[model samples]
Target: MDSTRTNKLLELLQTIGLQELNSSKLLSLVDEALIHVSAGRSKNFERLEFLGDAVLRLAATEFIDQQYPNLPVGRCSSLRAQLVSDRWLAQLGEQLQLESFLVLGPKALGDAAAQATLQADATEALIGAIYSGSGNNLEPIHHWLTPHWQQTTADVLARPHLFNGKTMLQEWSQAEGLGLPNYTTTEQSSRHGDPERFKSRVEVGSRLSANGFGRSRKEAEQNAATEAVQRLQDVGSEINSESPNNTPH
Candidate 1:
């Protein structure tokens, strides 16, 4: 790496709270992480992203185990899924302003719909770079990611349905012999990145249905499922309240 690019990489590390990091080898790894495949480089973020995927899962597992020791294994798995989700990684990239440092080809640069995916891939690669740069230590990864995980955990605990709505709804429907929830999605807008670009409707038998909107089809479907789950819960509450067992008798 040239002196100019090296200095820039150092600056980025500082921005990420990795201050006084002057190791050239680590800096090179970080540089590799920021390179997109479209850049036509012989080396890109692909390998690092793969490594980071594993590293991230392990780190998230450790975090959950340490923070919620009594949590059930199934719940721990669910929480880890959210923590290591591509959406979460993209959000992390946005927080770190990683787009500014990314090296993209003209095709990638002009593709707005793919921006979030690119960010997610690059962020995972960055995580891999950090872990590799630290001589395969988890300390730096934990030090950087623990706070984010804490905040995510709090949010998820407060509104658990929001994170795993589709799964929860599926389980509930099947358990009640209602079969699977059916989902139908439609594109609501042509503009990329629009929060309501897609609309989704979820139907469970003939008893319940809900609608939701989001930037992507999956998100819209999930949101619709979340609303459906909430409605089912409300109905159950009402049923229990009106039951003879809970009445004046």
Candidate 2:
């Protein structure tokens, strides 16, 4: 790579706390990672992104195992899912200001709808590049991602319902012999980044239902589930309040 490009990559590494690994091959991988397919390059980040997907999962699994050893397997699985989710990756990319580093084509630059996906893909590819660049060692990945994962873990734990509302609702329905919750989603808008782009309604058996809206179908469904869970909790509270345990005595 030329001096200017090398300097830019170095700056990016430094920004992400990876300044020590400054070799040419590593820089090349980083360069590839930041290149979108729309850039019309023969070599893009697709392969590295694929590798990064697995690497990210392994890293998340390890993080959960070490940090929350006593956590049940099901919870661990859910936590890892959040840690490696596309939404999480896109957020990370935004935090790192990765858009400035990306080399995009005119189409990609003009298309705002795909921006989040691009950021997510680029972030995953960057992780793969770091792993490959360091001789397949995961130490760098752990060092870089541990803090982020820790914060995310704490947040998820604090608002457990917000992070895994769908799962929690499903489990609640099954335990109550209510069968699985059913969800129906409809697209409400064609605008990218519209908070109410999709509307979702979730029903539990025949008596309980809630509606929610979000930028995507998954988010909309999750919101609906969250509301439904709240309604169920309210019903439980009401039943307890009406019980004869302490009636007017």
The Cα local distance difference test for each model comes to 0.84, 0.85
lDDT by residue (163-211, candidate 1, tens digit) is 8888888877787788999999999888666667899999989978999
Clashing pairs in 1: none
In the order shown, the candidates' Cα RMSDs to the true structure are 6.8, 7.1
lDDT per residue for candidate 2 within 1-249, as digits (tens), equals: 688888999998998898998888899999999999889999999999999999999999998787777777876788888999888999999998889989999988897877777888999999999999999999999999999998787777666776777887887777778899999999998977566789999998887899988778988998898788677676772211110111111
The top-ranked prediction according to lDDT is 2
How many Å off is the CA of 185 in candidate 2? 2.5
Report the Cα lDDT for residue 243, model 1. Answer: 8
Cα deviation at 67, candidate 2, in Å, is 1.4
